[model samples]
Target chain A: MVYAYLSILGMALILGVMGHRHTEVNHATVLHRAWRQLAPLLIRLPIALIAASFVGELIPQALFGEWLGERSGLSGVVLASVLGGILPGGPTVTFPLILVLERAGVGIPQLIALLTGWSCFAVHRVLAYELPTLGWSFVWRRWLVSMILGPLSGALAIAWL
Target chain B: MTVFFLLLGAAAGALLAERQGLEAVTGALLSAGELIALVIPLVIIAIVMAAYAQALLPREIVERWLGRDAGWRGLFIAIGAGAVTPGGPFMAFPLVVGLRAVGASLPICITYLTAWSVLGIQRILIWELPFFGVDFVVLRLVISLPLPLIAGITAQWLGEPGRH
Candidate 1:
């Protein structure tokens, strides 16, 4: 967590320098663009955090503790991967939900699997973006290759650790 | 739309906490405050990093290094560049298509997309670190390091229709 904060500070410093340079060249266009993107995150994230906190409080931790724990093992990985692919929304929603699960005792392997699945094989991204832009063939080929990635990663983590 | 749902969930959460009792309310608020504190700065920095990354790479450079015959060197280059390139599918997919048109191989293309998805530096610094912490992030990255290259090799061996 300290590393995260320090890294952010470092990035902010770089952004400051970069933003100033870009301002001289582009008259603050890039700065404005970055802010336009960040504004939504600033507003939505706090609300999501609040909801996620309550969700942590409300959901019985025993449920996740069992379902996503080491006891669940390979099956847990499969389930987490499948869940990750189906999860809706962007980072705000996904991260907070992950937070809830993590606090509720979902292990690192399962979380890793979840994130892998979300990134590599989320059906939403395929349908909404990849299919339309990259076409069916590219999507199909990639999707086929990706089907095992999440579970594979999870299993690997388990074996390695 | 997501924001709308978040608002609704927040409202429901607050109400549910109220019903649960003062202790629940206090607990939720404290945790939420802590998370918000942790997340906000990270989000701000991440947004800036994404913008910077978007500006850093030139399309020409990406195209030159990721061509069909570039081999393992091409694969490594694709992974590094893809990991750092910011924005969503809107930016990435089109860039991949453009690269493919200019003689980038199917395997390299697959490698690029997979690397971007799995190891996206911007997303990790912003979301994963803040939410999952450094430990989980590090482990995931370590385990994931081999995947894009593996996928690329697999694609090469398969030699599908899109092959050059």
Candidate 2:
């Protein structure tokens, strides 16, 4: 957490001190963009937390442990990997979700799925980021691939690991 | 208003204990607010940051490093970056997608995220080791290595279509 901040600070310092002379607006724009960068995170983080909290409460620890738990073997592995493909967003959300899901007795396989899905498939992200630039086809193709990969990879992780 | 209604529902649910309906309303309200506040914005910031990174970084640089020619170095570098790269892959992935637009390959992106989740430098250095133990950390690292590779290799193989 600190490193994330420090790195940002460091980057800012380098940009500010050495590169400031390039153009006044460039310097200002970097900072503006930085704020623009953070604006969305600040706005949405609270909501993800609240949902995760309830999800934690609703999902019975014992049941998740059984069906998708680490000890459940191949089926669990498949379930976990596929599940990973579905969820998407920041480490902030993903990490907490994983912790909550684990608290609910989610197995390693499922945990794997959650993490994988959060980062890899990122359905919402594709729409927000990639679709505009890469086109809808790239977004759909990747999502399609992720849907397949999430479960299969989890299974492989289970088998190989 | 929804929060108020939900809170009222929670109070009602608490009173009867049998009123799962009220509890449902409360939970729904909580989830709705959260979905709007957290999930929505998080995705948006992730996308914007991704856009900025895309705009800032060169496509050729990414391709040269993580492209097929990158070989083992790219793989290990990716794994290392994934492990240490802060933020969730969701946010990180936009950057990846941005990079992809700039010409990063499937494998590199996959490996980057696979490593992000599995290796997770932030989790390992900051939380897991402190909470679990060195043994646990080592076990996790040992276990995680193959997982991302499998994900990367397979995603690259199946999803990318035009590649060998």
Residues B69-152, candidate 2: write the lDDT tens digits. Answer: 566677777786676554433455555655565556667776776677667664454334332345545654665566666666
Query: For candidate 2, lDDT tens digit of each residue in A1-161?
Result: 33433443454444355444544235445546656645655544444445555556665678888888778777776666666666555454565466567667766555655555555566655566556655654555455545555565456456655
How much is B35 displaced in model 2, in angstroms? 19
Judged by DockQ cut-offs, the docking class of candidate 2 is incorrect
For model 1, residues A1-161, the per-residue Cα lDDT tens digits are 99988986787677667655763434255567678889987778888888888877887888888999767899999999999988876777788888888888988889889988888886767788777767877777787788788999999999978
Runs with alpha carbons beyond 4 Å of true place in candidate 2: A1-51, A88-95, A135-161, B1-64, B67-142, B155-164
Pairs with backbone N, CA or C atoms under 3 Å apart (clashes), candidate 1? none
Model 2 alpha-carbon miss at residue B98, Å = 6.9
Q: Point out where model 1 deviates above 4 Å.
A: A11-27, B7-15, B161-164
What are the per-model DockQ values? 0.57, 0.20
